[model samples]
Target: MRVLIAPDKFAGTLTAVEAAQAMATGWLEQAPDDEVVTVPMSDGGPGFVDVLSAALGGELLAVTVTGSLGEPTPATVLLHEGTAYVETSQACGLDLVPPERRDPERATTYGVGELVAAALEAGARRLVLGLGGSGTNDAGAGLLAALGATAQPDGVLASGGAALAEVTALDLAPARARLAGVEILAASDVDNPLLGLRGATNVFGPQKGVAEERRVTLDAALERFADLADRSLADAKGAGAAGGLGYALSLLGGTRVPGIETISAAVGLPDRARAADLVLTGEGSFDFQSAGGKVVSGVASVAGEAIRPCLVLAGQVLVGIREMRTMGVESGYSLVDLVGRERALGAPRDSLVELARRVARTWSR
Candidate 1:
């Protein structure tokens, strides 16, 4: 039997490619005679470029950009034909900062803007910007600055969320000029608004180390920046992605699209699933959000359309069995269910291998 294995990054544990490899190892260990095809998937986040590059066969152009804390960071931009693919996480992801050092107040998306500028210099007209895993909450103030929105005179623009308070005026005309003919698409799985409880600051700021006491101030600062930019785009979907990088890109005519849909279509997942005998996909956690424009749901949709059974394996299964079935998933295997949270998080590769072996014995037939 031919098995197609594709999974998203298991967050803090295994990446998409690693997840697929582990599942293949386990499946092949049990059924060595069976064939396994591995394809990793990402919902426009950390592994977006790698996944697309693998599928699209592109030239990877390397450039130096700023990290979240203003250090020189090396990043890759995938150039396929006339389109350029850039993942924000490659430059300013939260993973780049250690847990103790996380400070959204000082984080910046300046590197992301640098990547876009580099892509433009390469003659890219269509920009696919994957917006996730960001460490900043300055509402793209740093990105705007990098794209030529300095604070007037020789004074530099403030670095992070806190400095947005001093952004008395912004000049996006230069950026607009640079991106005049470029088509920007902000790919994001979340549809969070730019400001409010579900907005950038309150929902994502804590993850980037913005203390509870400082959320209001950062939110207010973002509100002020939005007031100066476009106050009406606050409620737009995807506006809150990557800690408000979505809202930032929108300033340059960036439109939002579901991350999973964008990636699936670009990589031809529907066609791949149609030709596969069985489809296996998973993620770090299969929860309520898994059904809402995430990698698992997107994979399941394509598999279902092909009348193929799609099984999900995860670190934890927060969504119920009925709900999982309703999403067209044949079943789900959980590391937490087999072992425990500690083992699941600490040794996910082993647990996943065991789970896949068991699934092959029980479900593979």
Candidate 2:
């Protein structure tokens, strides 16, 4: 049997490449005669840069950039020829902040700006910025600040969402000039809008440490900022991603595109999946979000149309079997359930390999 092992990063535990390796190793150990191929995947989140770099033959370039909390941190950007791939999460990810300091209101995207500046200094003619896993709700204001763009006091400038209520004006002249000749691409996987229940503040604010009562305030603030910027933030797909960074990018002449499409094209996933007898895809968690445009769902969508069997092995599987089946996933398994929550969460590598080996043994029979 020809099996394709394509899995996303297991969040805190393993990278997509590492997960694929573990699964491949386990499968090979149980079925030595079977053919297994490994393909790592990401959904334009934290591991996007690494996965894309490995698949696209790009070099990982390390640069010193400010952290989400304004601390000095060493971040990496992927570069190939005149194009640089920047995963904004590297500099502004929630994981970068300590639990006690997880305040989305105070967090900033300055580090992302620093990375972009460094890439531009390196002579990159084009830049693709992946937006996800961010800890800030500055709407890319901090990013512009780092790039020497100042926010107008009367323009829709807000700190987090609550502050948006105070926004009345916007300043983009400096930013426009700075980014004049640069082509900016905002690669995102979400379709959520800028404001409302399904918007950035309402859906993602809580996770970024916004208090329950503060959500509305933040949402309103983002609304005002969107209005002053003269951009139609309402119902704009992907405008909710990265704390309204997508909207900010749109205002800055950045084109928004699906992250999976870009990564798949770069890695040649569609062609490879077509040739495989079985395609395996997964992520840290599989639920409505997975079906809502994540890499695993994207892979499943493509594989389904091609009449290929796709299996999923996630760190945690929250979706019901029926839902996953409808998505064309032949089978779905969770490492957490298979190995117990503690073991799966604590020593994921060993547990995942063992589980994969057992599963492979069953299939071999």
Candidate 3:
């Protein structure tokens, strides 16, 4: 039997490649006669650069950029020919900020601009930016500032979203000049607009530690910046992605693309999974949200089209079996079911391997 293992990163625990490898190792340990093919997958988020770099054999270029909080951050971009893959998580990922210090009003995406600058310097005219897992709600103010947009005399640019209300002037000529010949594609996980109830500040602010008391303030700031910077993209699709970094890019002629589809095409996932007898895909947690536009959902759809059996192995399973069946997954397993929650969280790799071995033993001939 040929088994294709393609899964997204397990959030903070494992990369997509590492997860695929672990599942393959465990499956082979039990079913030695079976063939396993691994394909790491991402939805243009944290693992975007790493997965594409490995699959496309792109060169990784290192550069120093500003962090979410103005700290010096070492980052790398994947360059394949003239196309550059830049993951915003490399600079302003929520994981980079501590649990206690996560402040949507304070975090900035200045480092993204620095990375783009580095890619431009390296002769890249095609830029694909992965925009997700951000820790800011500045509507890309920091990014524009880094790309040569002048800041307010009162230091408004470096500050987070709340400071956007103090914007005194705008100078986008330099920033637009830098990206004149470049084609920018921002892969987004969400399609919310820049302002309103479904906007960045209201929908995503809480996850980054913005509370009711501060929500109105940040929303107003983003609105202020949107009006001052680019009122055209205020209601654009994906403008809310990555705490409004998508909005910033949209202001500079950046197009928004669905992340999973872009990645699937780049890695040729459908063609690879077509010949496999079974496909196993998963994530950190499998829940109702998994039915939406996620890596697991994308993988399952591909497998379904090929008439192949698809199974899922998750860290914590919340969706029901009928729901799994509807998604074309023959069955599903969660580490939390085999092992306790504590053990699953504390030792995920071991639990994942054990689960894979069990699945192979039960189903693989």
lDDT score for candidate 3 against the true structure: 0.89
Q: What C-alpha lDDT does candidate 2 achieve relative to the native structure?
A: 0.80
Rank the candidate models, highest lDDT first. 3, 1, 2
- Candidate 1 per-residue C-alpha lDDT over 194-236 given as tens digits, one digit per residue, 9 for 90 to 100: 9999999999888788899988998998898888888888789
Worst 10 residues of 3 by lDDT: 149-158
TM-score of 2: 0.91
TM-score of each: 0.94, 0.91, 0.96
* Model 1 TM-score on a 0 to 1 scale: 0.94
Score each candidate by Cα lDDT. 0.88, 0.80, 0.89
For candidate 3, write residues 207-318 as lDDT tens digits: 8889988888889888888777878788999999999999999988899998888888888888888889999998999998887778888889899998898999898889
lDDT of 2 by residue, 1-365 (tens): 88878888888889988898888887788888888888798778888888887778867789998887778888888889788999999998989888888988767777888888888888887989989899888777667667666555632242344555575556778777888888998889888888889888778888888999988877777677667775575567887789878877776788889988878777888888888777888777888778777878888877887688888888888989899987878788889888899998898888778778877766653
Full candidate order by TM-score, most accurate first = 3, 1, 2
- Between candidates 1 and 2, the one scoring higher on lDDT is 1
* Residue 16 CA displacement from its true place in model 1, Å: 0.4
Q: List runs of model 3 lying over 4 Å from the truth.
A: none
